[model samples]
Target chain A: MVNRMILANVLHRPIRTAVSVLAVAIEVGMVMLVVGLCHGLVNESAKRVEGVGADILVQPPQSSFLFGLSQAPMPMKVGERLEEIPHVLAVTPVLFVVNSVANLSVIYGVDMTSFDRVSGGFVYHAGGPFQAPYDILVDDVYAKANRVKVGQTLNLLSHEFRVAGIVEHGKGARLFIPLATAEDLQGVQDRASIFFVKCTDPAYGDDAAQAIHKLLPKHSVLPIKDYLSLMTSNNLPGLNYFISAMIAIAVAIGFLVIFLSMYTTITERTREIGILKSLGASKRYIIANILREATLLAAVGILAGYGGSLIARRAILAAFPTLSVELTWDWRFYAASLALIGSLLGAFYPALRAAQLDPVDALAYE
Target chain B: MEPIISTKGLKKIFRIGKVDVPALRGVDLRVQEGEFVAVVGPSGCGKSTLLHVLGGLTSPTEGHVLVDGNDFRGMSDADRTRFRRHKIGFVFQRYNLLPTLTARHNISIATHIQGNGFNPHRFQAVTSMLGITEKLEHRPYALSGGEQQRVAIARAVICEPKILLADEPTGNLDTENSQIVLDMMRELNRTFRQTILMITHNLEAAAVADRIIRMRDGRIISD
Candidate 1:
């Protein structure tokens, strides 16, 4: 511990020390940004899949084929027959189309009553919740973009619709309406894209979906949980590999920044380290000193980055308001990981050289 | 009946890339309790290496250094380090005080690290004896070279270590400062019966000690 106190003293180099701290802060900031984006991606996918919350979605096999082929909607009859399933709780048929509500703007529609049961609370940023049929619920993102507000009447597809609420969900501009209104717009049999079903018991969802699929061999029934899980799990084929590659790149960049900062600091303080070793200080003491400095810098850097990322989170959400951005306060993860990595990589050469310092040669070094 | 320090066939061979430079050859030396011995040598003549080996600052490539009948070689590095902290005190040419710390704190750190209880009375006495009382609160950079060396000496002896090893304590100072440092070393040897081994290239400095050993080319040439 001879040079422990001495090495602690040297951590106060004004400009160099601040630059090292900022380097750590920048690395942590970048990491926060990446983690936040990943969370946002997962959240956005889940919100979109479960948006109108049907326990099982029924679509005509041909309709599925058309949409799968050209991203087009199926005729609205498949939703009409889904109520025949024994376990079916509610069958809210949704007509998917890109059509204007009178003279105002293009909108997407879902059955109001079933939408209320499932994805209704997904829009907490607007006026109350969806109530009456033909009462459209617009996503807050589109509302802001179109400068529309709560209780405003919007015309779509040669019909007048009142804006019941503005929802903040994950991605895409959606305007929901009743199945009845959608049928009136496009002639009952030709407009419904999918049927959204809610099972009385959510746990029996997969079985109910299977039974419904068997009932109508030409129709596809998809459970909300299955669809949402597939959309959100991140481990799809090559997706995780891509995300892993990106994280690896971020971490590599962080390591380089920390290494150079610590290396430069070590080079600058070679003489001081030498002098301390000569004063009966052990190699272990010198290494511990460097570790302590790195840990301290990492702590400050992580906190700064976290605070800055909060502002960044707000900005990103504003840019893509449909996204449900998840911000985790798992500060300990970042702090501990950065501290361990910083000390491991940042203090390696410096501590080695500091330990290997021959007091006789070190004293003579100018 | 006991010598405070003794060494037999002490040698240090430094391996630099391919060449083995012998820093110290087989040498025998003895210092009785309370004796102040000065080792004088030319530059690169191995006196400092001998002091280092004797004080347990380093292990010798060959031979044995015995302090108070315990062999320096038999102990582990950790045990040796504790031995060095409790039994040895070092004073170097450049003072080697940490520039960021005040003189009092510098001395206190060495004492504290050894787990030696702080004696405010001893602190006051040591600072007064070394004539560093007024400069105790000042950092090394703020003090003169002579004052800094005095602080270094205070740091070394504060722990009441069994042996004091000073390497060219006044090599960076003027004659007046050198005299002041030497006078303090002599007073410490007299008052506390502290065994002192000082290494220097200056014969004038070595002459003040009770015994003088001269070394050349890593071997003791005369005693």
Candidate 2:
């Protein structure tokens, strides 16, 4: 009977219930989307970097695991010396520019001869390698997204470049240009952000890295296979804190909305509460009923949030082809739990206040 | 037999800021088991306050109260609430049936609060006797005043409490509905031999009880 009353009370005020549920749904969805985008981008970028077929990577001292964040470029001669290491088959100088034209993207500048040799050559879907210093090579995904053809010109870094080729994606970046042109345009001539060394055998990767590290004592030299696993929010500075703060803000939204909703509902139901007490409802019983309503609302909101997040992920992927939003089950569980806990806490005080109401006064309440 | 209800020096004072306004002034009262009693008074005459004190809804500023062999003074709030659940049932003037629930659920809530499972036999018998069996599926707003009050009466007596407390049970009803409600109370008292204590301002409503006690200025005037 009490359960029926709870359900009836929840349904009695549909608008209030909807507002509360929507607030909770937005909170859960916000947390899931933020966490998903952060993790998805990092994992996607890491996989693309691994696709370069490099066995070893070298960067300037104190450079981050994220290639795009490497601010100080190392001298291009670093690639020449890396090729001398034992078991190193080829070395390529890659100077990347983090550009924001239509969207945020990293355009890698590579020396064609060494890049082709190190990456086993690009599998062209349309045109071939860069034809001129002003030519740009785009991957299939980028070409399809931007609707670019072989001869179409694109403005990158304030310079016009003709599209020379459309290659299969997964070669470190979606867009590429010749190394010399990139260095000249970027004002980093004779310098590269990273040196990608391809080894004769995968097993010689660590040895090549150790040899390179000994030569450039202060620089960062890492075996690519192992470094791929290190590219996570946990390993990245400030990323985890950023994600935590976003989740906290989401939970706070749920808590505040639920608190206000339950408080006002309790106040409005003062007379009804008196009726229940006069019927012999204990404090625990009253509290249980109130919390039960909150939990039911949260449960519905969680399901809505899950569905909304999936739809949003699909829409986002369609609108922004380069952006990856990976919705993990682990984060889904965490978001649901946080919403439930926050909602429970929000309803607690109002339940207590209702339970403490004097039966006589509550009965007399208008 | 010892009285079913006994109160000594029952006094209740409302402290409004610095002024102490007394609602029940040392009024001692007693009623036997299986008896119907009505407390009657005009506005500000402590009849409702006396009913509240006897029902354990509020504590009297000065008093000793014993009902059905349980001492109200020795019981904690939890104990009183439990006692109310099992031993006392209440009906109010406004027929405080939860407006959101169907008439059936409104009555069933009292039985639920007693932590007792639904008894189909008792439910049918109670609702049938009160003539609310056909109205059970309707919410309070759809029910007439007489029907709503009947539902409230059924809710109170469904758990078969030892005592029934009513405050102005017919105060909000039309003359015909008030008469119907009064007849049901009389029937409940006679058929079940239930102990009933009612507070009312209507002399006609008070006349239905076996005994009527009148009060004025917080003291018993006559019986």
Candidate 3:
């Protein structure tokens, strides 16, 4: 009966209930978007790193594997030296460059022969293998978005190149060209951004990375698995804090809105609360009534938020074709729980106030 | 026989800006079990305050209240709340029925708060006796004043509490409705053998009770 009364009370003022539900829904939606974007970025980064299929990445000492954009480039000769080491089957030197057109695009320049030996060769959707110096490869998503096709010429850093092939999505970089061509365009000859070292056995990746670290004591040698762990765990500099702040802000918005709404509701029902007390309602009974109302509102908000987030993800992907926004079940469950917990916390004080109201004074309230 | 409701030298004071305004000034009273007692007084004569104290809604400033052999002063707030749920029923002048619930739900809510699920037999008997069985599905707004009050009465007595405290139950009703409500209360008192303490200012309404206690300036003047 108390539960029914609570539901009826929530429906009693439809406008207020709608507003509260909307507020919670918006907060949950925003949190889901933020969390989804973070997870998508991490997952995509790990995929790209794993796509390299290298046992170890050797870069400048202070460089980060997250962006892979280091001002100081490593010498291409480092690959030859790494290949001389035992258990190192193949070595590929790649140049990482960021091109600014309408938006920032990451470009990878690789020696096709050794790159394919170290990393499994790319699977082409349109055409196969680069034949000319300026032949380029693009992912399917990028190709579709940019309307690029085989036998079409595209510009990269004021240099024109023919589209050699369109690879499957998630295969490699959005833009890929010959290492010599990238070196010519960037005016950085005989130097590469990083070295990808493949071991004879996949299980020897850790040993290979340690050996590389010893050989090139001045440079950084990181195992691919470690880089992935760092990205997923949010241990990268300032990333964890940024995600935490976004989550905190989302929870605060939900909590404050629910708290104010329930507090005002309790105040408006002061006389009714007194009447309940006079009817032999315990404090727990009163609290349960208020919380039941809040929980119902939160449940509606959570469902709305989940639906809204799916639509938002589609809209976002359509607007920004290059960006990845992952809406996993884990994140959806997390968003719903956060909203419910925030709303319950918000109702706590108001429920307490209702329970503490003096029956005589409350009944006398006009 | 021991009194169902007893207060010894009960006093209640309201503090307004450091001024202690006495509402119930050291009044001792008792009503035997199964008796319908009416307290008649003018506005501000402390009849409502006395009722509030007796119902355990408010505590006395300087005296103790013993209802059905349990001292309210010896119980904590939570304990008093439990005590009231099991032992006391209250009817207010405003008809205090939850507007969002049907008459049946309002009546059943009392049993719910008492931690007992609805008893269909007692509910049917009470609503049938109060002549509100046909109006059970209607919300309070759809009911007439007399019907609303009867629903309120059914709600108050549904749990079969040991004592019933009514604060001006008919203060807002017309003479016809007031008489009808008063007659129902008298019938309920006789049928259930439950003690009832009512506060009112109407002499005719007081006539239905087994005894009338009149008050003046927060003190009983005539019985």
DockQ for each model: 0.24, 0.83, 0.84
Best to worst by lDDT, what's the order?
Answer: 2, 3, 1
* Winner of 1 and 3 under TM-score: 3
Root-mean-square deviation of every model:
5.5, 1.9, 2.0
- After aligning candidate 3 to the native by TM-score, how far in Å is the CA of A319 from where it should be? 2.3
Candidate 1, B-chain TM: 0.97
Model 3: per-residue Cα lDDT over A66-165, one tens digit each? 5545767878888789998888999888888787877777788888998889888887899978899899999888888888999899987787889999
Candidate 1 residue lDDT tens string, A1-366: 334453455455767656666666666666666666766666564565565555676665654312222133555555556666667777755565556333222345665555565444354577865567668777766688567888889876656778887777542226667666666665655566666787777787888888887777766656766556655426444556765675566556556665676677667667666555544557787677776666666666667766766787788778765445556667337534764485457667767776676656666566
Among the numbered candidates, top DockQ falls to: 3
Candidate 3 Cα outliers beyond 4 Å, as residue runs: A131-134, A151-162
On lDDT, the stronger of 2 and 3 is 2
The lDDT per prediction is: 0.71, 0.91, 0.87
lDDT winner among the candidates? Answer: 2
Q: Candidate 1 DockQ category?
A: acceptable
B1-45 per-residue lDDT for model 3 (tens digits): 888878888889999998999999988898999999999999999
Compared with the true structure, the alpha-carbon lDDT of candidate 1 equals 0.71
Candidate 1, residues B19-112, lDDT tens digits: the string is 9999998988888989999999889999988987887767888887888877877776566666776788889898887777788888887766
